[model samples]
Target chain A: DAGVTQSPTHLIKTRGQQVTLRCSPKSGHDTVSWYQQALGQGPQFIFQYYEEEERQRGNFPDRFSGHQFPNYSSELNVNALLLGDSALYLCASSRGQGSEKLFFGSGTQLSVL
Target chain B: GIQVEQSPPDLILQEGANSTLRCNFSDSVNNLQWFHQNPWGQLINLFYIPSGTKQNGRLSATTVATERYSLLYISSSQTTDSGVYFCAVEEYSSASKIIFGSGTRLSIRP
Candidate 1:
C-alpha cells in the first residue's frame, strides 16, 4: 500500500504569486490535513479537509486555503505568497477526521524568493 | 488554545545510548502522537499513543492523559535515529485540530 504522497517535492515561487501543492492521501484514508514547518520550528496546522469541505483551520490567514476531492486527495493553495511563506508543507492523512493516527508525506519544500 | 511544550530542545549522544523526551500539554487530550522529522524534513509517525504505554522495537512511548503529558523513550540509539521528535495533541472537544510541541532535536553520533 502506498503512503501519503505529495507532488513537486520542491518548488520556487516569487512574491505576489500564487502556488498550489497537491497531496494524495494514503489508501483507505479519507481525511487530509496540511501543515507548515518553518526553519527550526515544528509543523503548524494550516487546515483540515473532510467531506470535501474545510472542517477546521488554524491561526493562518485567508491567504491559505485547501480543497479535498471525492477521491480523498487534497490541494493546498497559497495566494500572494510572501518571503515568509517559504517552508516545508506537510500533508497528513488518517482514516477519518477524528482518527488518532496520522500518516504524513515527505512534504513539499516551498521556497519563496 | 492548548499549549504544548517539549523539554531538552537539543541533545547529542553516542551510539548505544538511551534518551527520554518529554511533552507536556496545557489541557486534556483525546489524541496524542509522536513524530520523528528526518534530516530531509519528513515527518515520520512514531506513535499514536493517547494513553497508557506502547512499545515498538527500540522505541517506546507513554502518555498520561489525565496528567496531560507524554514521554518517548529511545533505547540503543543509532545514528540513523538522529532527528527532531515532535509531540502533537488533539483535545477531545476539538476533533479536527492538533497542537504540536516545538520538538526535541536528538543527534546520535557513531
Candidate 2:
C-alpha cells in the first residue's frame, strides 16, 4: 500500500493567482477530506467528498472548492488567493462510514507572495 | 461547531524524562486521533483512541469520553520525539468533519 499521496510538495504563487493541489487517497478508501494548517497551528477542515459529491464543509470561504473523482482521488482548488492563503494543505482519507482511523498525506506547502 | 483545546502549548524535557499532553473537546465525538507532525510537515498517525486506553511501545493514551478529555503519555523520550502533537476529533453531530487542536510542541533534549 502506498498510503495517501499528494502532488507538488511545494508551490509558490502570486496573491491573485489560482492554485490546485491534488491528492490520491489510500487504496480501499472512498472518502477524501482537505484541511489547512497555518504556521504554529493545527489543521482546519476545509471540506470532505464522498462518492464524488461534497458531503460536508467547514467555515471556509467560496474561494476554496474541491472535487472528488470516481477513483477516490481529490483536488483542492483555490481561486483569487490572498496572502493569508499560504499554509500547509493536508489531505486525509478513510473508509466512508464507521471508520475511526484516517490516513494523511505529507501535504502541500503553499507560499503566496 | 466543536472546539478542541490542547494544554501546555510547549514542552521541553530531558531525554530520559516522561511527559503528559492533554486534549479537551467541547462536545461528544465519534472519532478521536493523535498525530505527531515532524519537522517535514507530515502528520504521522500515533493512535486512534476514541474512548479508552491503548499502549504502543513507549507511548500510551487514555481517553475518558464521559469527561471529554484525553491524555497522551510518553516515556523515555528521545530527541526524535521532538514534534507537534495534535488531537483531532469528529463531532457526533457532524461525522465527516474533523477538528484539530492547536497542538503541544514537545522537545526532548539530550
Candidate 3:
C-alpha cells in the first residue's frame, strides 16, 4: 500500500502571500496531523484533525490553520507567509486521535522569500 | 507543556561502530516514537515503543516509561545510517499532539 503522500514536494512564495499544502493519509488511517520542521530543528506540532474537525492545536499563531476532509486527507494553510515560515512541512497520520503509531509523508518544503 | 530532550546532539562514527541515543521526556506519555530523517528528508519510522523493548534488525529501542526515558541502540552502524534521529512523544494531557525533540544528528562514515 502507498504510504502517506504530500504535494507539492517544494514551493516558493513571497511575504504576505497565502499558501496551502496538501496531504493524503495512509490507507486505514483516520487522523491527520501537521508539523513544521525548520532547518536544524525537529518537527513541531502545528495541529491535528479527526472526524473532519480540528481536535488539537499547538502554540502556533492564528495565521496557521488546517482542514481535514471526509476521506481523511488534510490541508495546511498559512496566511501571510513570513520568511521565517520557510521550513519543511510534515504530515503524519494515525489510526485514531490518540497517541498511536504514526506514518509520515515525505513533507513539503516551503520557501518564503 | 511537556518537554522532550534528546542527547548526544551530534555523533560521528565509523561504519561497523555502535552508538546509543537517549531521549528524556518531562512527563508520562501514552506513546513514544523514534524517527530517522534521511538526507533526502524522509522521516522513516524506526520504532513505536511506548514502555518496552523492540528490536528491528541491528537497531533496538527500549523505553523505561516509569523513568520517562528511552534509549536507541544502533549496532554495526552503516554509512546509510547517516541522518538525524528524533524522539517524539504524546502525553496524556496533550490530546493527540506529538512533541518532538531537537534530534541527534548521526553521521556514519564509511
Interface RMSD of each: 0.9, 1.2, 0.7
Chain A only, candidate 3, TM-score: 0.99
Across B1-110, the per-residue lDDT of candidate 2 in tens digits comes to 88899999999999999999999999999979999999999999999999899999999999999999999999999999999999999989987789999999999989
List model 3 lDDT by residue over A32-94, tens digit each. 999999999999999999999999999899999999999999999999999999999999999
> What range of 10 consecutive residues in model 3 chain A has the weakest lDDT sum?
A94-103
Per-model TM-score versus the true fold = 0.98, 0.98, 0.99
Per TM-score, the best of the predicted structures is 3
Which ranges in model 3 have alpha carbons more than 4 Å from their true place? Answer: none
Please say which candidate is ahead in DockQ: 2 or 3.
3
Task: Provide the lowest-lDDT 10-residue window in model 3 chain B.
Answer: B90-99
Residue B59 lDDT (model 2): 94
Candidate 3 — which pairs collide?
A: none
lDDT for predicted candidate 1 compared with the true structure: 0.94
The prediction achieving the highest lDDT against the true structure is 3
Candidate 2: misplaced stretches above 4 Å?
Answer: none
Q: If you superpose only chain B onto the true chain B, what TM-score does each candidate give?
A: 0.97, 0.98, 0.98
lDDT of each: 0.94, 0.94, 0.95
